[model samples]
Target chain A: MLQGNCEILKREQLTETIFDVTVSAPEMAAKAKAGQFAQIRAEGFFLRRPISICEIDKAAGTLRFVFEVRGGGTEALSRLAVGEKMDLIAPLGNGFTLLPQGEVIVIGGGIGVPPMLGVALSYHGRAKAILGFRSRSAVILESDFIRTGQMPVVCTDDGSYGKAGVVTNALVEQIALRRPDLIAACGPEPMLRAVIEVARKEGIPCEVSLEQRMACGVGACLVCACRTVKNGEEHLRHVCKDGPVFPAEEVLL
Target chain B: MNRLAVTVAGVTFRNPVITASGACGFGREYNHFYPLSRLGGISVKGMTLRPQEGNLPPRVAETPAGMLNSVGLQNPGVDAFLQDELPWLEKQDTRIIANVAGHTVEDCEEIARRIEGSAVDMIELNISCPNVKQGGAAFGTSCMAAAEVTAAVRRYTTKPLMVKLSPNVTSITEIARAVEAAGADAVSLINTLLGMRIDLRTRRPILRNNVGGLSGPAVFPIAVRMVWQVANAVKIPVVGMGGIATWQDAVEMMMAGASAVQVGAAAFSDPMAPVKIVDGLAEYCADQGIESISEIVGSVHPWE
Candidate 1:
């Protein structure tokens, strides 16, 4: 990983509380992968905020990060203007490993949809995407997912948008039609649990990206540990180093 | 060039900035960011006699100026550390201070015996872990219990021993003096202070364990105070830690009577923090025209 000052190239409000920020970080963007995250240092905050890489533009030497203003740290991050420099450590954590030449179904919920955009763009196979949001106004990166994946499905809980159901409902329907070789997902715990349940029932291989409140983006601190079973023995794995991404069967979700 | 080297006990470190235990796991993870040889020493994560699963999730919470963690000594045990982790760590060009924790006196002695002739340069007895319910804070909070544990481990090994002290105690110097009397070669002070945070919405504790150890800039002043008091009370060298983030912090810690300082929570904000302090100390030495970095140790003079 490398630490450098990233110049904010652009910032846009994706929704009421969510934002899309593009920063100039050639070294980090060059090595960044789909599921890996960057730790952004905010002024007045003691710890760096860990945000996953939403998109990587290698040619432009920039990276896009989508985050919600959930706490003081992100609120500080959201206040940064264009051309401002922010300290960052990037290309952290083990990212998703894409399999070649297979039908893959990608499921995402809320803030989780942004990282899937990177995976969709990089997968060298038939990739389909299912995005779930709270309402029509909460939907983000729909057009980007459409441009990158084969078939993009959008769903909302309140029937305010396309399909008017959860992402897992769409996942189950897609699994019935053409059984994807792999299922990849990222989102809140409840949504990830639902997706994992469906994948297990269908006997489809799956991978998941986990979110944890972290201190060190590096593996040094055991702040982001999650339970996982390896070879029948349960162990606590560091989400920052061992993975932000792990096989569905391996993780005890 | 000024002599940055410091000889604590029998082993000599190239510098005086070691990565605090529990912050830097087994030296493998942070090695990707910078070479391990650049550090003065590395205190590997707290190890135990048996593999521990640690505390339940939501193990960390961010406070105003620091973070609290309740990772209850999650480790692969001594055998695994010797077999799987130590081989890789032995190759690194730095001193290895193995931080060991236990629930009983035998557990402490057994682990000390196991690592006696191993790759580790010294054994740092972790009697100060506040997250665990047993053995840790129990032994560290009292002078008698702290001395007993230190003496027990001293009997099993010939290697230099450093007892890591807790900041939660009423009299830190009392425990420091007790450990020194029990044949401890050195002492490291101010392990995270016991603290808790509550989630107002849920009306419940933030950590699953309800209480955790707090560390970062918030605890730096406490660490300095404790280190100064312990340094004055003990004859053995004292290693200071707690919220040391910058090169200036390191210098201040040395003046407070610490032979060396460990960088802990600061590494979370900047992966290069420890290395930056190491280089920054050299620059400070050169600019101030100090012949040796050791000259600043315990140099603070208060106007009485």
Candidate 2:
């Protein structure tokens, strides 16, 4: 992993509480993979904040980050203007495992949609995205997902947008239409549990990206640990190092 | 003469900046940023007799100029360190100080015996971990308990022993003198001070353990004060640490009577923090026309 001040190439207010930033981080963008993250240092904050890599454009030497204003740290990050510099530790955490040639269904809920877009881009036309949100205003990255040559299946809980329920329903419908070889997802724990259940029952392999309050993003601090099982032995794993992404079978969540 | 070198407990460090234990885990994560040899030494993560799972989530929380961490001595056990971690770290061309922690004097002695012939350069007894339920800071808070654990482990190992003292104590000098009389080679102080942060919304504590050890720039003054007091109280060498981030902080710590210094929370804020301090110290030494960096140790002339 590399740590330095990467120039902010672009910054956009995606919604009332969400933001999108692209930075001129050649080395980092070149090394970044889907489901991985970057720890961006906000001015005056003790610990750097961890945000997932939403898009990695190697050609432009830039990485796009989409994050919600969760606290003082992220709020500070959202305020930086273009032409500014943001200190970052990049391409951290273990990313997703996508087969070279296979159909995959990517499930995303709310802010989790950004990371799925990176995974979906890897599959191009072969990946189907099931995006869910709280309402029309909360929905984001619809057009970005479409740019991957696939019309994303959007779902809203209040029926303010696409379908009238959660993404799990859309997932079941799409599964019956065409059985995907693999399932990739990122979202709240309940949604992940439901997605893992569907993948387990259908016998399709699944991988998930998890989130936790973290420090020393390189995994030395052991602050972002998750209880997981492997080969019948349970152990606490660092989400930042062991993975932000893991095979669904290994995660206790 | 080595400009930045300072000898502590018979071991000659290339510099005086060692990465504090628990802040840098086994020297693996930060190795990608810079070579481990850039540091004077490394105190690996705190270890116990058996693998410890640590505490629940939200183990860390930030505060004014500092952060509270209640990791509760989570480690892969001392055997794992000797078998798996030491071989890799010993090859890093830097001194490795294995930080040992446990719930009892017997526990400390048992781990000391296990690592009696290991590659580590020293034994840093971690008796000031405030996050654990027992035998952590509990052992360091009292002179009798501190002396008991220190003397027990000193009998089992021939390696240099440095006892880490907590700032939460009423009389840190007494504990420092106690460990010194018990045969400690040196002392490193002050470990994080016990602190708490309550959540305004839930009317609860932010950390799952409710309290954690506090460290960062906020604790620098307190650490310097304690280091000054302890250095005066004990005849052994002092390795000052706690909230030391910049080269200026290192200069102040040395002037306060620390033979060497360790960088802790500062490394978390900047991965290259320790390396940067090493570079800056050399520059400061040259600019000040000091022939040897050790000349600055205990140089502060207190007016009081």
Candidate 3:
């Protein structure tokens, strides 16, 4: 990924809270993967904020990142004009592992949904996507998911639209009906933990992406390590190294 | 054509641009951006005898053109590195320098002894880490303590020793001489200067640690000055770091007496900085008609 400042081409609110931002990084788009992320430096900020790559069109030479305005950096990103340039360090961190021989079930909650969208688009297997939001205004990417032909199952807590329940309720029903061979999830910790527990009961292999407050996203600071039980051994693995994506059974949610 | 190389205290580096310790974290995450073997070498994060929790929130703050960090020597401890990181780092073609630190002289020695026969190319005694409550910054500020710890580790292994000195010391030359007399093979300076930032609204320190080590472009001039002073005083090869983000900065350090320059805070800005620096340095030397990069090492003494 190139380091110099590149201009922002577009910034639009997909949902009330979630915004889709596209930046000018031709090289990053060429090798961009669904699970990889970019560390973005807001013009006045010293440290860059890590945002997952939501979409990439290599031929078009464009990269897009979806972020929920959670903090100063992201809020700053949402306020920027189209012609403004931003310092972006892209295509970072390990991404989703492509598994063969199974229908893929993609699950997402809140802001964790964007990164998984890229994965669903890339998967060659039969893909079923389950999306969750607190209410209708918080929901995003429904049309995009449909455009991918996955026809994502939408769940809202308030019953403003779609299924009136947590995404897991929809997940359980999907598991019973479709019995997808593999599962992937990215969301709040509790939701991922629930998904992991569900995937385990069905004996289906699953992967979960995590988010931690990180400093040096490159693993130097040792700031964002998650404890995982692997091979019956408990270990602290760097989220940026071992993964932002880990097998559901292995991570200590 | 020769792919210019540097040999520091008998250890060979394919080039002189190395990823500084505490910046590149054993070369794993950065490997995603470029091949880990592309750099001259990588100095792993500082390892202590036991796992350290480091500092609290707001550990890093921006100061003018620099940044301050009180990360408090947070590491996975020596055992974890030996088990988890060392084997993987050893497999890479680049040189691995183990940066060792502790709360006491014996602790430093114990950790160094543990890595005696491992794949580590050298030992960089981190006497400059300012985040810990004990032994880290304390030892580097006093020549006696610096010598005590340097000699303690020197007795255990014959591996090359590179003592990292703090700029907070009253006389850098005295500390450099102390480590040199204690048998250090080389010296690296100047570790971040001790400084703090104020959060005007809260009317307190911006960093939770109250004080942090300052680094980045703001400290480049100071680091070059200290490297020049220490390099002249001890006769030991010096590795200079602090705000080195570009080829020009690397050249400035080498001319100021650094045999090799370390890239720290700059890595926070660009993960592939070390690789870009390695490539850029070569092009710069080629354009300058310099046969060997070593020719520019210490070339700034006359200017001073």
Candidate 4:
């Protein structure tokens, strides 16, 4: 990966907690794929922040990344202006697998919504979305789905908007209506667990993107690890290596 | 444009700037940032006979200009390294130096034998990991234990072997001499010093293990003095490292009697620091009209 400074082309508040940022990384954007990530820096920060590749326009040499201001690096990222330059290490980790056409359900919660947006744009055939947020203010990327003409089901904890429940409830309702052949989810640990449980019960194939505190962002440090059950034995796999995505059943909740 | 080439134990490195063990992690991560072929060499993470899960969380903590880590030598077993990591490493242009650690003599022997025919160019016996409770720092603290482990590995591999010494010991000279006399091709020192940080609010140690190895800019002077002492005591070549962040620090190590320097803790501050140090050293040499960097090695202490 080449580290370079990219001028921010645009920045918009998708929600109170999340921001959709587009930067100009010609080399990165030219090569970036749907499932990969970028290690971005807020200029003076010591550590680089990892953000998923939300979208890319190879010809225009612009990359879109969605991030929430949870930590210091992201908070710093939110303060940058349109023309400000940011150091970014892109296409750093493995991306999502492009599945063949099948009945698919893309599930996301809060910040996890961005990773699935690209997949939704690529895969054809019957595709539905189950989005979860704490309230209306936390929900994001709904318009992108609506623009794509895929009517999505949304869940908010306080009934502030959409269905008044967790995304899992929305998922169960959707599955009851018609089971999807494949289920994909990314969100907080609890929501992912619920989604996995629902998918397992319905006998639908499912995958979940995991998050762990990481240093090095590569497989070497052994810092960002998640326990997984493989061959009937549990072992630690680097979240940056074995996956940011893994079959839901294989991961140890 | 410069001769970054360095020779240790008759083996030539394309450049003197090898990626320090535990920092570069088999060289794959850095490969993402730059070309792996650009490095002089890469010391793989400390390995063992069997896979280790290593210490608990909060394994690392930041201190003033330095950081403490009790990673506890987390590594996949020798078998896993051989089956999975080795073949991948062999493809790289950089030299592979396996940093091995163990809880016992037999463990070291098994790991050495396992790596005998592998593509690795040398073995760095990591007897100096202070964070572990078992045989690591214990062997490094005592000359007798240092000699014993070195001899065990020497019996297995004819490849050049470097004994990594600990700084926690009272006399680093004694440990250096012991490893040299025990058939070590070279001796590298001083590993991160044993240290701990206090969390005032919790009124307890910040690290989950309560202690960790201190590395980075804070440990440079200590490492330089230890390298000087050890170099004087042993005939074997010395690879010195502590908080080497720039070319000047590297030059200090070389002048202090280090044949080559390893950049640790500094890598966390800047992933490309080693490359910059290598470039800076070349520029420094060129301006001084020095033909080879080896000319400046041990050039300090003219009065002595």
Candidate 5:
């Protein structure tokens, strides 16, 4: 909802492909929520890259962004250093919903792990973080989850890390041990589909963050169309406006 | 004289900046960035007789300074626009031009007729949309077909009618003149040029539609040249678009004979693009000591 040339307060190359940076955008940080995203402008690119807010440091007046170098846009973005200014349209799309005084389980997959951090932190000490990565080196933000006043359960596909399977495996294991009030996630469509199915079977409320090719991130362009069902009928929703996040039942896929 | 306002087809705009069809939607989303009243006008999403779901993703793809979209005129039906969006747009203190697209002449006329009794200010006949299978760029690529649809819609509406021209045609000026002869009060060009992009890994077109209309800085020069040609070909006002991103692009477009200009894909980069162009025009006019921004229209003295 705000445009500012925020200065990069810190930057770290989490891995060769992933990046972690925090920007000084106080007003946007103040208005930001756990599941929202920021459309960061890369120099010379026509479309701004949509990066999910990994963490919101309201006291420090900064918001953390974590992303992988997917293509040209993110490749250009990954090259920026600390002290550089990046133009951003922040706190966009709907964020995950939180319940009052209830234990929650936050699940994330690969790059999808970032969006869940803010929600996990909000429920600090009472929240559980189960993350899945392609391998151990691809893993990120373990220490940050520890900052949430809890130890995280990390899983790698190669079994080079904590658990030897996907986050759904961790999710099912955790769900059976003790039921959490809610589950929230963001990741690949197939993975989200699996997570949604598991949540539905368990009768647990869930919200997921979706991604789409977008232009006019404000929803005026209608490029980022997401399909969902309402009242026994299918409807087209704007991922940029209606949500990057939606309830598990409302989403069609 | 007002510095930014310009008259098109006897209708005065508070500014020469309008958001092109398919760019600003119905002014509902961009309203969060800034007030819509600051714009001279907004051409809402292209509408049909019934609601359209538009093309499936990926509907847009980035290529250099521009982007391509095959949105395929997704919109709520005309009746829904009149009932749901028109009232909210009317309260915004900006001109509302309903952009109508149809598969046939009757379809376009029906939409125009429905807008006749509403608070809408004008009707922009969209014969240039490139994504649809029929009646979009098909009617626009031919002079006779463009004229036929223009004349049909003209008979149905008392509103000032503007025909939007497609750049995919052989001679754009011929289509512009044909629409003019068929009772078009004005002409807006150029709609996105037909373009395609493929991913090397997938070895398939990036957009779901395979091809889309390209807009942005990459197409600005073509738009300027076409606007100049069409502006001279027909006596009707020329509302130019395509890559009118920066304030400088607006000045260059106006100098090429556009009475007004529309900001298209550029607004996606920055929602305040048109508003910034409005302020930039004021600054440029003041510094140049020009009394009216309209004074610069077609003022480019080309070398002999």
Candidate 6:
């Protein structure tokens, strides 16, 4: 990981509460992989906010991250403008590991869809994406996923979007149509847990990205620890360092 | 350049800024951001006799200007450190302080014995960790227990022994004096104050451990007061910590009677805080026209 000043190349409001920002950080853009995150420092906030890498433009030396205005820290971050310089610790935590030859199925929920954009792009049209949102208005990055993946499915809870119900409903239908060799997902804890269950029943290998309230984006403070079972024993693993990503079966969630 | 060197128990440090235990891990994670040698010292994550997985999830809660953590001293055990982490740490041009924690005197003694003759510059007995179920804060709250643990570890090692004292005690100076009398080379205080936070929406405690150690800007003044009291009562050197974030806070800590200061929770928010403090101290000394940074140690003069 590296710490440097990133200049905002572009900033846009994806939704009322969500923002999509592209920043010029060559070093980070070069080194960052899919599912990794950056710790962003905002003006007047003591803590650096951790946001996942939504997409990357290596040729242009820029990276895009989507964030929601959760509280004061993110509120300050959303106010950043073009040409503004921000301090960031980038390419942190373990990223998703890609498999060689397989029909990959990607599942994302709400803000989780952003990280999957990078994953879909990495798979080079061999991946199918299932995105879930609360409603049509909360949808984000649907066109980006479609541009990268094959047969991108967008679902909403209130049936105001492409498909009704949840991403899992689409995931179950997709599994029956074509059995994917692997599954990669990022979303809320409950959604991830449901995705893992389907992957396990279908015998498809799955990896998940977890979210935790972290103090230090590095492995140090152990503030972002999550419980996992490994070798028949349960232990605490740091979400910032050991993972924001882990094999779905290994994580208790 | 202004002289920022500090010698605690005969171990010389390039500066007076040390990364407090539990905040920096074993120095590998932070090393990716900057060189570890840029700071004066690194008190590694608190270690135990055997590997510990620490507490359950939801172990941290952010409060106003600070945070509460109940990590429970999770570490890879002493043998793992000696085999895996020590070689890399020894190469760094900074003082290495092994922060040891245990449940009993034997546990503390065994950890010290294992680390003896290793590359560590000092052994910081973590007698004040407040998050554990046993042996940590229990020893720190009592003068006798603190001294006993210090003497137990002191018997097994020739390295400089620094007892980390907790702020939860009734009298911090009394505990400092007790550890000093027990042949401790130096003392570090105050470990995070015992605290807890509740989630209003859930109507439940935020941390899984319920009460964790509180550190950050909120605990700065309390740490300075305890450091001054302990420094006045003990002849051995004092390493002050708790809520130290900036160079001004470091200088304030030194003036209040700390030979060195450890940046703890603040490092979580800003990874460069300790290194910045080191640079900030030199600038302050140069601007003040002070030849030696030691001139500020215990220089606070209270009106009679």
Fraction of native contacts (fnat) of each candidate: 0.74, 0.56, 0.24, 0.17, 0.77, 0.70
Best by the TM-score measure: 2
| Clash pairs for candidate 5 | none
Candidate 4 similarity to native, TM-score = 0.88
Tally clashing residue pairs in candidate 4.
Answer: 2
Model 5 chain A is weakest, by summed lDDT over 10 consecutive residues, at: A96-105
Q: iRMS value of model 4?
A: 2.8
Summing lDDT over every window of 10 consecutive residues in candidate 3 chain A, give the lowest-scoring window: A218-227
Report the CAPRI category for model 6. Answer: medium
lDDT of 1 by residue, B1-304 (tens): 4367887888889999999999998988789889999999999999999998899888999888899999999988999999999999889899999998988899999999999989889999999999888889999999999999999999999999999999898899999999999999999988999899999999999999999999999999999999999999999999999999999999999999999889988988888889999999988998998888889999999669
- At residue A145, candidate 3 shows an lDDT of 86
Per-residue C-alpha lDDT of model 4 across residues B1-304, encoded as one tens digit per residue: 4556788887787777777777777777877767767777888888878898777655666666677777788788788888988898888777888999988999999899988988889899999988778879989988889999999989999899999989988788988888899999998888888889887879888677789888888899999999888888888899888889899999999999988888865665466788888889889888888888888778896564
**What class would a CAPRI assessor give candidate 4's docking?**
acceptable
Misplaced by over 4 Å in model 2 are none
Best by lDDT: 2
User: What does DockQ give for each predicted structure?
Assistant: 0.77, 0.73, 0.22, 0.25, 0.79, 0.72
A39: Cα error in model 3, Å: 3.7
Q: Candidate 6, residues A96-122: lDDT per residue as tens digits?
A: 887777789989999899999998888
lDDT of 5 by residue, B153-248 (tens): 999999999999999988999999999999999999999999999999999999989999999999999999999999889899999999999889
- Candidate 2 to truth, TM: 0.98
lDDT of 6 at A140: 91
User: What CA RMSD would candidate 5 show?
Assistant: 1.3
TM-scores for the candidates = 0.97, 0.98, 0.77, 0.88, 0.98, 0.97
lDDT of 5 by residue, A1-253 (tens): 9999999989999998999989999999999999899988988799899899999989888999999999888998888889999899998998988777788888889999999999899886778999889898999999999988878999999999989988898899999998999989888888899999999999999999999998888888998888888888888788988999999888977
- CA displacement after TM-score superposition, residue B143 of candidate 6 (Å): 1.3
lDDT of 6 at B4: 95
Q: Per-residue CA lDDT of candidate 2, range B1-304, in tens?
A: 7799889999999999999999899999999999999999999999999999898878889988889998888899999999999999989999999899988889899999999988889999988999888789999999999999999999999999999999898899999999999999999999999999998999889888898889999999999999999998899999999999999999999999999999999877899999999999999999999888999999999998
